[model samples]
Target: MKADVQLLITADGSHTAVNQVLNKTYHSIHGAYQESQRVYIELGLFSAFDAFPDGPIHVFEMGFGTGLNALLTAREAERQQRQIFYTTIDAYPMPPEATSQLNYDQFFGTSYLTALHESRWNEPVEVNPYFRLTKIESELQALQIDERFQLIYYDAFAPTAQPELWETEIFQQLADLLLPGGLLTTYCSRSYVQRNMRAAGFTVTKHSGPLHKRDILKAEKVR
Candidate 1:
């Protein structure tokens, strides 16, 4: 599937993509870069690293929208000299034409974003010595893998747009894919979503969200 997107500048003067089909923005409109930095990088990645201090960090992302999260993680990996293995899946991969227009490269003063978008799908490519990435072009429900992750970036469209992804079954599958003490972070903090996560055996906690958002979720697989 192809995603028709329109590039838009966010409140933090960063670029984000709006999916015309889903009527949803890839990142928070308030601040795309800020949101990813807070919700995924700081809250999710750093926390996972703290929990598992040694060895390469393995991250699985539910949505690979604009590749912003992966790019930031790769940058952090290089900066901190930490090894990272990132695997991300997307049902409707954004077209190259749309991604080329994003200002992330200019904002970050690097061309890593372009490299990430051009990387081959379903194969791991070392973006740098500290970071390796594998992009999977598939729907989450149809995906099958034996690799377990220490962190999950649950960046799918909102529940209203794709409620199936937030169902108990889906959450259970994700929970099974996480290692013990693994974390799953998302911009969504809806009560029903929390309930589903809880039913799937996760300890859910609400955290302060980024700009324009009240609360986000950081669920842990304590078993």
Candidate 2:
């Protein structure tokens, strides 16, 4: 069944995609940009830079969604002059009409967002001097990435909406992708999810979330 995708204005004046069939939004209803900035950029990318300074950073993101996270990450990379190789996977890639409704350009004031969307999938495309993106058109179950990454943006749909993606087995595979001291950040803070991450060999930590959420989860590979 095709998802009834529609654009909705979030609390922070950004746009989000709501899959009516699944009864879920592509991002937090409170704020799309706010959630991406706090959970993924501030916590995931910046923390990785602090921990692993003076080298290229590889980021693997689950659920590419509206490509908002990718655009934000690309902008940050250029601003900080940091080398970033970003890889994101999505089974259900959004159509151009839906992505066009997301007014990220209003916030960032750059056309890089268009470049990000127009970039070819299943291949690396250099968006700028500091950032490169490889978009994989595949589901998590079919993914077989070889490189161990320093950071992962676990931006999948909520566990309640997609329970199978949050299971122990899935977490185990994700844990194995992390380099030692690697980090994974997400907007989820469910106890069962945290416990599964721990079982997968991560040292999990919970931090204050963005608007409308109490906490977010950040897990690190200690080994």
Candidate 3:
């Protein structure tokens, strides 16, 4: 089924899409760009780079909504001169019409955003010298991933919208996919969600969230 999306201007003047069927916004209404920058880029990617410090970073993203996170990561890779292998999975990939309406490119001053959405699915595409992207179209629970990653961006819809993705079993699968000392970060810091992560054998920590949100979760595979 094709998703019906409504374009919206977030607090920071960036565009975010709302899924009409699910009644959920693809990003925070407070500020889409700010939320992605703080949650995924600062808290997740930069922290991962600090932890490892050397080697190409491998990233696994649970939801590739809006392609905002991927675009930001690609820019970061080039700015820091870091090599990143990004693998993102999305069951409902947005169509070109919806993606083209987004104004994320205005901030970066580049055509990378368009290139990212235009890149073929289920195949690796080098967005730039420092960033390689592979977008997979599959349901997270059904997909089989053989490779492990150093960082994971868990950007799925909230538990209220998709509880199955937040279950202990699902988190266990993610934990299994993380290399030792690797971490997973998400915008959700709900107690039940943290409990599920702990149940999956992850060392979970809560951190300050972006605009309007109070806390977020960072779960590590310590063992």
Among all candidates shown, the one with the greatest lDDT: 1
lDDT per residue, candidate 2, 1-223, as tens digits?
A: 1245888888998888988767899899999989999999998999999999978999999988888899899899989999999999888877777777778888778677777777788989999899999999888988998988999999988888999999889988998898999999999999999999999888999999999899999999877
Candidate with better lDDT, 1 vs 3: 1
TM-score of candidate 2 on Cα atoms, chains taken together: 0.96
Instruction: Score each candidate by Cα lDDT.
Output: 0.93, 0.89, 0.92
- 1-223 per-residue lDDT for model 3 (tens digits): 4468989999999889998878999999999999999899999999999998999999999999899999999999999999999999999988788988889889667678877888888999999999999999999988898989999999999888999999999999998889999989999999999999999999998899999999988899986
Model 2 segments more than 4 A misplaced:
1-4
lDDT of 3: 0.92
**What is the total number of backbone clashes in candidate 2?**
0
Instruction: Report each candidate's C-alpha RMSD, comma-separated, in the order given.
Output: 0.8, 1.3, 0.9
Return the number of clashes found in candidate 1.
0
Given candidate 3, what's the lDDT at residue 110? Answer: 65
Worst 10 residues of 2 by lDDT: 1-10
Candidate 3: residue 50 lDDT (0-100)? 97
Model 3 residue 137 lDDT score: 91
